[model samples]
Target chain A: MTEVATFLFSAIRVSTPLVYAAIAAVITQQAGLLNMAVESMMLSAALAGVMISGATQSALLGVLGGVFFAVLIAMVIWYSAFIMKCDLYLVSISMNAGLVGGTVFVMYLATKQKANTIGYIMSKTVGKLDIPILKDIPFFGEILSGQNIMTYVAVIAVAVTWFLIYKTKLGLRIRSVGENPSAAESVGINPVKLYGISFALSGVMAGLGGVYMSMGLMSYFARDMVAGRGMIGVSAMNVANASPAGSALFAMLFGVSDTIANYMQIIGIQPQLIAAFPYAATIVLMAILAYVQHRRYQKYLAKKLSQSGFEI
Target chain B: MNKVRKIESIFELARIILALAIAYGLSLLCLILVTEDPLEAVYMFAIGPFTSMRRFGQVVVKFIPYALCGVGMCFMYASNRFSMFGEGAYLMSGCFVAVVAFLLEPFNLPLLVMLPILLIVGGFFGGLIGFTPAALGAKLKLNELVTSTMLNYVCLYFSLWILKVYLADPDITFFASRLLPDNVRLPQILDRSTIHAGLFIAPIFIVIAVIIFFRTRLGFSIRICGSNRDFAKFSGINYYKSIIWAHTIGGVLVGIGACVDLLGIYDRYLWNEITNYGFYGLVSAVLARKNPIFAPLGAFLLAYMHTGASILNYTSEVPIEFVQIMQALLILLISAQTFLRKTKNKLIFKDSQDAIMKEGKTA
Candidate 1:
């Protein structure tokens, strides 16, 4: 029972960053932008946040710095993609590569250390929350009691994203722009501005994800540490059809797989092979989701035809 | 009419120059902010490659694999699919070459006998990697981008496994394969530089790619399919066959590039991660606007920048990665179709109006 509790706790902890990234992906994807540069934004933010926090010794300043850097990068992406009319995928890929190199370059410039890591700097880490009432409960409490503040922020973000996306005026405009930009423009909504806003919001979420990586998970920045988590989150958003709650669930599923991979490492499995499991799971899950969506669309078509009294 | 064509070509040249200037400007700004000796850094970045014969040779050596990868990527981009399996194919092909070269060492085979077999095996495996994504897309409707990206990681891990289990040199502390025999090593082209026979081989493939792209029915079908799938279908082109062939050819090129890079640069296979030559190739292809004819130029430009960056790193406090930022800015600026579209349109419109007026006056 304790083992299961420990596993669940670790899973939740691991899922926090994915949850943040998925929410970010959901926002931009719903706004009809292929924001492949989220990984870059997260990486830049992670480095900026850690560097700033290390200098200032303030976690709040670090988080804010991270978000600011991320939003700045996102705006650059938006400007390049929309205003300059560059291919979004190419721009994002270039930005991703740039950020990877930029982070390492900056880290080396700052510390004259190895480009692979910036762990030596005594940066501030986000404190974990141990809820009093939750800690007193049983195995369930053990799973829920102590987690980083970013984990709570991630949970709140899901609800906030759901509300902002489904229950607000701007949400409607954003969705309209995604579904039919011409229609949105006809109704006096500037699709470009809305898309820009969505990108900014996505940047905030991705920034928080980066903060979680550096401050919540580990108090240091590593080169390419986000790995393919950004891609995994994008896939989660795809599998969830851009729903905040659904993406959160999928993120947790990935988190579970990740936890399993870590546990397998304890049993003497090769770390390299184990590292590939989450990516493999993501591919399989994406295929299954695509198949299911296809079948559902077929069923919906059949039902609609029958209702309209048309022969199959 | 001749004047208009001249003006248009001049404008095209200006666009590339403007993009490159802005990219360099930004990189200079970064250097000023970061380095204490900014002028020296800038000088190194701009003129360092040409200052030495050795550095110039390094640029030539780097250009070989990059150009091959670029040409390979041109096929896929021309076919309108972004199959990123070139990265995996490069890695896997390198592994395959190491394994084959090691196995063939016992026989003490001559370079003539071994090289062709190595190329064929490398190309076959790489093409197989490329085919998997294409087949998956054709049959299952999976997104090639995601599948290919995942396959890159899969290939990396699988290659690592092969290295650790089968080919590892126990004498070395780090993960690396046994060194190839002297007979199997690529013969150096230059007396003092690392430039090898692979530089010659790279151009042959480029010529073949040029021929295949322009003088073949399959290439025509792929181009047509890429431009308009519905139109291609209406015109009786086999969409799946064209796409599969394009991707497979791309994979073969990258695979061959990997083998060349391995033989030219290293005595043993020591790559623990994706070579990233495939990504650089992709960048070269993009910069060439997916034109096979211009891929070598694009590859040369990238290789030159890298050589400059390495020189800058050697000369000053600036890191080599500063070139990555410059490359990214250049790509973004150059790829931006709308950047100077209004000016271009205005020039063409004015020229056409002038021509029309001339015709009216003559009549």
Candidate 2:
């Protein structure tokens, strides 16, 4: 039971960054943007957090710095895609490619190490929060009480994302823009402004995920440390059809598989094979989701046709 | 209509040149920030590739893969399907070709017999991988970009697993497959360089791609579907078939690229990462404006810059990763619809005015 509790704790801990990334993806997806550059945002943010924390010796400043860099990248992407009139998808792809190299370039300039900032700099870690009453419980407390502060923020982020999407006027405008941009413009809402807002919000969420990665989870920035987590989150958002709650659930599912892969590596499974599981599983789940969605659409079409008295 | 097209192509060329200049300026800025002698680094980066025959040969060798994948990407982009399957296709096909060569080595086949078979296997395997995301996108409406990227990771690890399980070179310390047989390795064409027979092979594939893209009905259908979907639909074009064929044919070219690249460059199967050849290919295709005939020009520019970056790597403190950032900038600026929108509009406007006056005089 204790071992199971430990596993659950690690799984939730692992899912924290993913949850943040899913929220980021969900926001842009809701705005009808692909936002594949979420990966790049998180990456640059991770490196920024490390550099700032190491330089300033303040984790809070590091978090703020990281968020700032992520938002700046978001604005750059917005400028190129919107102001410069570049293809949004192509811009996102270029941002992903550019920012990774940009981060590495910055990191090498700062630390003179091309690989990581493990020993070259002294950086503060984000504090872990232990709940008071919840800490008294046995297995459940162990799973729920003590986690990185970012984990708690991630939980709140999901709730806030739900509330912001469903209960706010801005949310209504964003949705209207996504549904039909020309219609939204006819009604006096600028889709471009909403896209910029969505990009900023997503940048903040991705920034938090990156901060958690370097300052909370690992205590230092490693080159390409975010790995495929950003993409995994994007896939989660896709599987959930851009719903905040559903995205979190899918993220947790990936988290569980990721935890299992880690343990499998310890049990003598080839690391390469074990590492492939999450990506392979994501593809399978996405395929299944697509199939189910397709069927639902077909059923809806059939129902509408039958109601209109049209023959099959 | 012809005058407009001619004007548009001219503007397109101008956009590419301007994009290249800005990207180079950004790279130079990065070099200035890093190096003690900025001018020397800049000089080496800009002009070093042309200074030495060996370095120029390196550019030619690198150009082979980039041009091959770039031509392939033209087909994919022509159909408006932005699938990233080319990356996975090349890696998987390269591994498959390596494995097949290992199997075929026992027959003592000559180079004439062995090379074509390996190329066929590679191209076929890549097409199979390519068909997956195409089908998923066409039939299931999954995002080909995301699925194809995920599949690249799968292919990378799967290929590595295959190497470890079936063909690990016990002699080598790294997790690489055994070296290919002597007869299967591509013969060097240059006197004192790594430039191989692939220098000829890449152009052949490029020519074939050009013919397929410009001279074929299927290519026409793909272009029509991409440029105007409703028109294609009303015209009774098969959208799904065009999408699938575009990706599959692109996959075949990418697979051939992988085969040729492996044969030209490596003695053993040792790829451990998703070589950004596919992404670069997509960038090349974009630079070409999805025209297969111009894809080589894009490929050559990228190869020259890459070779220059490597030269900087050897002589200066600057890392070659900056080239990626520059390449990204190049793609963004080149593809920006509004980069020089006013200038293009003005040129077209002037040309139309001139044409109208000429028509009036003729009448």
Candidate 3:
């Protein structure tokens, strides 16, 4: 039970960034856009959040800086895809390329440092918030209490995103635009506008996620640090079919697989192999899904062909 | 009409040059940010590759496989699939050929004939790498990029697994396979140049790719499919077949890259990860706009920059991230509308819903 408790808590913390990016990915995908820049956004935000707070000696300033740069990169992505007519996903790649480089470039500019920086930004980490009368509670406290403020934000963000996606007018437009753009266009909806806004919002979500990760987790920004979370978000997005709640759940599952890596490895395989847990899991899951879908599609095609009595 | 054509041509050239300039500028920014001796380090990073004949030769040798991968990818991307499976294919090809050379020590076969045979086998199997996602895309309707990327890991890991299980020399310290027999090696060209038989192999196949691409009905069908599948259907082209063929030819090129890198330099089968040769090759393809013949120059330029970065590494505390940043710059520049064609948008994207559905299904 103690082991289980420790594993779950660590899993939630590690899984937080994936959740943030996955949430961001879901919102963007909802608007018919595939943004690959989430990784870049997170990296820049982590740095900015860390740097600002480090400079100001204020965690709030660090948070603001992180959010600021992430949004800026998001805007750049929006401009390229929306106005430039570049493929949104590819543009995301371009933005990712630019953002990471941009952050690195700025790091050199500000600190005259090469790749990595010294200390967490503001030299301040996100402090844990102890809920009143909760520490003495058993499982509930173990799971929920003694967590950072960002944990609550992630929880609230997940809830709000679910609410917005299912119960809001903007959600309908986003879904409509994504599903059938031509149809949406006929109904006086701007597919590009919806996508642009959604992508920007996705960037912001990713930004917030990055900020929380930096201050709340490591309390410092490192270069090339986002690693594979962006790709993980891509995995989570696919697994959940862009459903916010589903994505968050999958992200946690992914985090658990990752958390296991920190512990003992099965057989002789190192934690590095298991570090690819989310990707490997998604690949297996996807293959099965594809086979089923293929069967279903073939059946439908066969039924339609048979009814027509003529092969077109 | 001629004047208008001239202006458009001028603008296109301008864009290409501007993009290159920006790519360099970004690297210069890295130089500035490292806050080093701006002029000295930047100059070394840019012009350091040409400081001497040996350096030039080293640059050429590096450019050799890069060109091989580039021209190979040119054929594949020209066929309109944005697949980077060549990375795994090239690495595996090199590894396998290394293994084969170790076992086959027969003196009966002539050097020329034996080398071609190995090259052909390597190319054939290497081409097999291209078959997966191309097939998956056609048959399963999956997004080729995601499928190809995953397949890369599968191929890389599977190769490592094979190496660990079958090929491990028990006494050796590092994770590497057995050394190759001397009889299977390519005669080095100039003493200085890394130039091997594979460098010549690239051009030979590139010519074939060009002739096949422009002169044959099959090639025409590929171009048609890339332009419009619906139109290709009316013109009697097989989209699936064309994709497969393109990837197959691409595989051959990539395989040659592996074989050359293996047989020419290192005589052992060992690679911990897929080399960036495939990515560089893809960059050459993008820069060349899928034109097979134009790939060498682009490949050389990218290689030269890599060498320059190597030079930079010697002089400073700057990380390899600088080179990767250059890669990002190259991708951005190459994928831009004018640097290549406006075709990047068409080839690189799928319908969002379709892509999500396909990638999701595969994921």
Give the Cα lDDT of each candidate: 0.86, 0.89, 0.74
- Tell the DockQ for candidate 3: 0.17
- Can you list each candidate's DockQ? 0.59, 0.78, 0.17
Model 3, range B267-287, lDDT digits (tens) per residue? 667787657677778777766
Candidate 1 lDDT tens digits, B342-362: 898798889889999999999
Ranking by lDDT: 2, 1, 3
Clash pairs (backbone) in predicted model 2? none
Model 3, total clashes: 7
Alpha-carbon deviation at A168 in model 2, angstroms? 0.5
Global lDDT of model 2: 0.89
TM-score of each: 0.94, 0.97, 0.84
Those runs of model 2 whose alpha carbons end farther than 4 Å from true positions after fitting are B1-3, B350-363
Extract clashing residue pairs from model 3. A50-A121, A53-A122, A54-A121, A54-A122, A286-B362, A286-B363, B127-B251
TM-score-based ranking, best first? Answer: 2, 1, 3
DockQ ranking, high to low: 2, 1, 3
How many angstroms is residue B309 displaced in model 2 relative to the true structure, after the best TM-score fit? 0.9
Better of 1 and 2 by lDDT: 2
lDDT of 2 by residue, A1-312 (tens): 998999999999999888988999999888888788888989988998988989999999999999999999899999889999987778877777777777888888887888899898798889999999999898789999989998999999999999998899998887788788899999899899999999999999999999999999999888788887888898899889999999999999999999999999999999889889999999999999899888999999999999999979
Model 2 lDDT per residue over B223-333, tens place: 999898889989999998888999998999999999999999899988888888888898899989999998888999999999999999898778778888988889888
